[model samples]
Target: MSLPQPVPPSWKDLGKSSNDLLSKDFPFQGFALEVKTKTPSGVAFKVAGNRDAKSDTINGDIEAKWSDRKHGVTITNTWTTSNILRSQVELENQIAQGLKLDVTSSLHPDKSTKTALINAIYKQSGFHTRGALDIFKGPTFTADTVIGRDGFLVGAEAAYNVTEGNVTRYAAAVGYNAPEYAITLHGLNNLKTFTASYYHRVSSDVEAGAKAVYDSKSTHGGVGIEVGAKAYLDQAAFVKAKINNAGVVALGYTQTLRPGVKASFGLALDTTKLNEVAPVGPSHKIGLNLVFDS
Candidate 1:
């Protein structure tokens, strides 16, 4: 028999019941399973399909790793309906002087695309900085940089649209963090849009957050705000909700059924369109997850 995993009381701290976790859409609606096992040198990973009720298809990935204290290497393969779809390999190492470096390559058989990425990060004097480079089959290149410290973090990223053969978009963000809360300001596409968010833990079991967003190109062309809250009903269950100035509302509940088993339900509504000529109906979703250690 599997031992019962003791559930913790700090739901808000874990973001388990947090509505602010999602930026643009409702929570996922599917079932997933994962199993991990310890090897002599590293670990093995298996992730089963994130099965959706609407679709009867199943997919999964398997991975193996070899590692020690300083470095590791991993390889993975993914399959769907008996068809091998993708493969990926990665290598990472912590070099002398506290520098960490990693390289990854991936191939998608169905898409006829391949990608390679290299990155490095280093830390000193309580400061951290990192950079990355990506190359895809279209000969496209992208670069990113990030720097951060305890209470402050910032980053900038730009991507080359390989398919479009153009450098199209860029983004940046700055944030301040504390033990009880965090706030962030961000911009995308050279300030074509902006967003600001703040989150605070009201207590050990409850948390609240709000976000304000602006898009110069939107129909409204005005700032919109969203407020969210999460509360732990007990160690085994929790609920979360969010409301936005656009008259959109979302609510979710999660419950831990047993060790390695969990479930969730979600509902979303658009109050502004409830009684319109072409009424938009409410939406509901459900999900289940199972995890195991072999």
Candidate 2:
């Protein structure tokens, strides 16, 4: 008997390239800094801050996590501009052979919201199916399911507002995967909006992808689009670049400084904003990231 082949991991490589492009465009006002440390017992601690030098604005958060083979817990506390505290906690466990459960709670000093999620997966004769439910959040619920065989997948999801007694949103997706390339199409808000993506591995060291989104309700002149590529220079270094329909371009490079340390830098520019008449060379930004492990 021949064994079934598993899906290729190249899709993640494609996503990494896109994420490098999107990081600098975060809705937040400024650049971000993050640090993480893991202990021998699988406990981890993290801290992150976002700062804008021009505005002199900063936001920070701290998190801690502990995990074993089958169960995990995490807690995060955030400090907003008004110095108000918000905390979130999550717990996850594998309850049975193919079933998993997760619980999360978001809390302010005065009030709290809680949610529970259940996920299950099954596979047989080359077919796989997974289903999940996100329950009890402000009287809201989301249910989703996915099924796949070989290299093709389809998924549907819907959300309901219990208090309002209405279905708020619905979405669906279809995807196909092969050794060298993959594509997916997604529809949201009862098909009023759509997004599609394609990824391809050009060679052993190069991967490229593009994404586009459209919304029928919007009066925009053109679809939102982005294209990106990532290349591995060697075992220790890689570079990425992306350009969007809005005339903004970004470039990033990451390198392993040593066995347990890594560093990265990114720069972005909006070419359309640069002109003699505008008196601005370009709306440009730069960011750096460093990671350490013990």
Q: Tell me each candidate's TM-score.
A: 0.72, 0.78
Which of the numbered candidates is closest to the native, going by highest TM-score? 2
lDDT at residue 71 of model 2 (Cα atoms): 56
RMSD of 1: 8.3
Candidate 2: C-alpha lDDT: 0.64
| Backbone clash count for every predicted candidate, in the order shown | 0, 0
- What Cα-based lDDT does every candidate model obtain? 0.62, 0.64
Query: Which 10 successive residues of model 2 have the least lDDT summed?
Result: 7-16
Per-residue lDDT of model 1, residues 1-294, tens digit only: 544322221111222222345432234455667676766656555555567644645566665554454455455555444444555554544344645666666666766766777766554443445555666544555555545455566666676766777876677777766778877777877678987888888998998888888998898688989888888999988888888897877777777777655566666666776664311222434455566655
lDDT tens digits, residues 1-294, model 2? Answer: 656745222222223333434453332234566678878777677777777644667777766666555454455455544445555454444444433444444444444544455444443343444445556554666666555557776767777777888888888877777778777788888999988888888999998888898999998756999988888999999888888999987888888889867777777677876552321233766666666654
Q: Largest lDDT belongs to which candidate?
A: 2
Task: Give candidate 2 regions above 4 Å deviation.
Answer: 1-30, 53-55, 70-94, 110-137, 276-282
